[model samples]
Target: MALPPADDLPPLRAVVEAHGLAPRKALGQNFLFDLNLTAKIARSAGPLDGFTVFEIGPGPGGLTRALLAQGAERVIAVERDPRCLPILSEISARYPGRLEVVEGDALETDLAARARGTPAKIVANLPYNVGTQLLINWLTANPDAPFWTSMTLMFQKEVGQRIVAAPGSNHYGRLGVLAGWLTRSEILFDVPPQAFTPPPKVTSSVVQLTPLAERLACDLDRLERVTHAAFGQRRKMLRQSLKPLGGEALLDRVGIDPTRRAETLSVAEFCALAQAL
Candidate 1:
């Protein structure tokens, strides 16, 4: 008999149990078994019809299956856990040529190369341990020509707030500055911790970031340095907090008031400081 369509596969929990794959805390695995929720996330990434979707930590293929069923051109999932490979292979077999599973740490893999110069998007429920760092890696991968056209990611809610936070908000920090400087980011919606296989202590949010078609170009390291130092001592005045980076002189050169606190600076102001440095 012909196999069931890709969308008609058994429930995610069944598949996980069949493969003896239990969520591993060591690997930051919290599988989302709800297909409807996963599908909403897939659509939130915008049209995936002709773009490759690069997914990280696709435990049990919840979002992977959703991306394929939603019409992604291809999905290259980088999974660190060897246990999940079999399930992913099952997905690949069901979808035939549409899915490719790479067994490795996503941190070390080059997703851009995987896309092979084609327009691509990244959608994943990133492992908590490396989510922020992974985002930084992608954001700074190559500012001049970002490999992924857009990124739809899930992060701890507080972290998500920082990404889309504006100047003066308590959430505004290094992530906010960098993300705001490079792209337009917004929190699509909140995902309660209860949604996962083994729930996390904190709530999560799905955030989408689209690169600005035209943004003021600035050096990544310099921006990182400025934000790190400035926010490192967030309550201090620019003159005092930015002392390691030429402090008062740097602010003056960038036409910023030295007495202003780090949180007062806009994303553009932070970039200005970096460019001035």
Candidate 2:
């Protein structure tokens, strides 16, 4: 695909330098100066036309600008760092009504409220420090009715793998089970460490998740409790690990082998166990 034309605003590097913005480790900030990459990440969320995108940790508005340029109907960005406000404001000015910058912790922001009945997509290079928790919050926000149409997020490669991991895989755990129970997820691509302003020690990956129209019938809290216990002592057999819940008797009722380990259980099995509990 042909790269979108850069907006008339100054390059991200210049914006960062002019504003005295340095990628802060404490904030998990790693600015992406590569507009092409940003545009690619925005596009991965599928068509943006007529969609309002909620972006978290839009440091310096690199991805924010890309979303606007790529035809997003609107971009609502939640940024915690006050230092990036001026630069983000500059992008908002360039895009006029298309960009809205919210100055607050994304974890606390009520994204569904901000989306306001519009079709929403979340596209972000999430802050590493809180990326997983943010995703979990979104997934468990409304089990019966997900707020967004899709989510295209960048996370540390290991974390990304866990989101899309399958049962029986080494990476499979609570994250994988929870995500699989809610969405159809896959890793779209890997991003090298060198892509960011301050390179992280590990590579990054972009993962896309589209909510299932109808998720399996299970109590979200119960499922969470079941997985937590099962995977908390992953090396042990289910009979031992799940002893607090019911042990071999529980597995017998569910028809799953008591000797099976947590990693071997499918999302359906976990849901069944939760339902039984």
Q: Could you say which candidate leads in TM-score? A: 2
Evaluate model 1: give its TM-score: 0.96
lDDT of each: 0.92, 0.93
lDDT of 1 by residue, 16-91 (tens): 8899989999999898988888988998998999898999999899999989998999999999999999999989
Q: Show where candidate 2 strays beyond 4 Å.
A: 1-4
lDDT of 1: 0.92
Worst 10 residues of 1 by lDDT: 1-10
Give candidate 1's error at residue 104 in angstroms. Answer: 0.2
Q: Write model 2 residue lDDT over 1-277, tens digit each, in one string.
A: 6565678888888888999999889999999999999988987888899999999999998889889988999999999999999998888888889888899999999999999999999999999999999999999898788889999999999999999999989999999999999999999999999999899999999999998987788998899899999999999999999999999998999999999999999999999999999
Clashing pairs in model 1, backbone N/Cα/C closer than 3 A: none
TM-score of each: 0.96, 0.98
